[model samples]
Target: MNDLHAVNTILADHLRIVLVGTQHPGNIGAAARAMKTMGLSKLVLVAPEKAPDRDTLAMAAGADDLVERASVFASLAEAVADCRWVLGATARNRRIQLEPLHPRDAAQRALVAAAAGPVALVFGRERTGLNNAELQLCHAAVHIPSDPAFSSLNLAAAVQVLSYELRCALLGDAGSAGQSRTPPPTAEVAAHAELEGLFAQLADTLDQIDFHKGRAPDSAMRKLRRLYLRANLDSADVRLLRGVLADTQRMARIAGEASVDKKIR
Candidate 1:
């Protein structure tokens, strides 16, 4: 096997392709075919409308093994529970702010994250794409550029495109002489679940301190989530933030009690 093939061989083990709320069973099969063609095997389905059925098997063609081995998840969070990094594949703009990257750049970022642990490439539903809340869970968004006249791409086709980009990123140019193939030093990034716990603590503390003022807080919280996720915080940072939030909660409660005592006096 060539150098490119060797790089893809290792990259495949560290990357996972996740489909969220996939409506068509055929699309699942086609996606599996796409991944298999690109030397990817870990396929995760998040709450598909239908499980891998006869259509999926038929559409998968020779990649039936991937379909059989695919794992089913009830939610996106559950699907990427263990992944240190998640890149959402989205075509449309939404209210939530996310770091957007071209397919190639996203592939590079994914490879770096995969050095540490599992990295997920998430695809949303066929019709509406990922919801705002779902997108917030992702560390970044991968956008595939196409003609402005008709930009809509098939779900499986999108998967194929991203998978190809990832492969290219791993392989490098054939002309380049003796490029390094060793994986970078993996960062000790906190997992999604740990970050989610910190976010919960943050929200409660913010509420205790009236941080939102009079306006609705969802938008602010979404932005904050994006900000912190982009920071790629490690376990130590997460622990420190959570501890600070706990202290903030306690201080706010004490202040409230003191005000009550003053009013009573």
Candidate 2:
């Protein structure tokens, strides 16, 4: 079994910055600088209005390498397709059903998710912010705390704030060394293929009950998958869940047969 603490440490070093539909090249440059300060290097730009400019290079300062090697994508979906966990930065609360996490908390959770696969944090455009459709693509939303009365923050400032929090969380505070001496307990976690099979069984049962009659089944299933993935279920937990599902399906089948017999009688 892999050491859980070591796994978390490696994951912290492998985070990615994903900018979606960014309009200003300067903000992109500034974001790269902020990411570099936190030891993050991977960057993916999705459908930006302008490519990197001279002004951006000037603003980037010592982090020119990060900006120069940043990959550009034609769509947000393509940008985060390989990422196991995708987080979105948003100031205004859309009151969507998604769980809201602060930057530090998000980073910590992202570390755990990254242990299983790659992780990406998506920042929206400066003007209108992430639309509902774009937000749906992310697994979770992160909100930075600001003064309630006046909470407007510049795009680069937001990036800096999140990056700073991530750096601190990954590095920890003064007493962190003592805490790190004793590693956290590790559990056997479920594999991706096992989770996929569980989800398929659950979806089949839901379909039998017509739970998704009025809803988009694919979207609903995807949301359920996101929620389960966020839970980070261990192998034992997965088995327990699958057992419960099997019992539920058996009861449903028995109930259906009894109803049919009554109707015939």
C-alpha lDDT (0 to 100) for residue 53 of candidate 1: 91
**Stretches of model 1 off by over 4 angstroms after superposition:** 1-8, 174-186, 263-265
TM-scores, one per candidate: 0.91, 0.68
Q: What is candidate 2's CA lDDT for residue 166?
A: 66
Tens-place lDDT digits, model 1, residues 59-115: 999999998999998999888878898889999788876777778777876877777
Off by over 4 Å in 2: 1-9, 174-226, 231-265
In candidate 2, what residue range of length 10 has the lowest lDDT sum? 176-185
Q: After superposition, how far is residue 198 of candidate 2 from its true place, in Å?
A: 11
| Highest lDDT against the true fold, candidate | 1
Clash number by candidate, in order = 0, 0
Superposition error at 16 for model 1 (Å)? 0.6
Candidate 2: tens digits of C-alpha lDDT, residues 28-113:
88989988887778878999999999878888888889999999999877777656567889888774445677676776666656
Superposed by TM-score, candidate 1 places the C-alpha of residue 185 at a distance from the truth, in angstroms, of 9.7
**Candidate 2, residue 75: how far the Cα is off, in Å:** 1.5
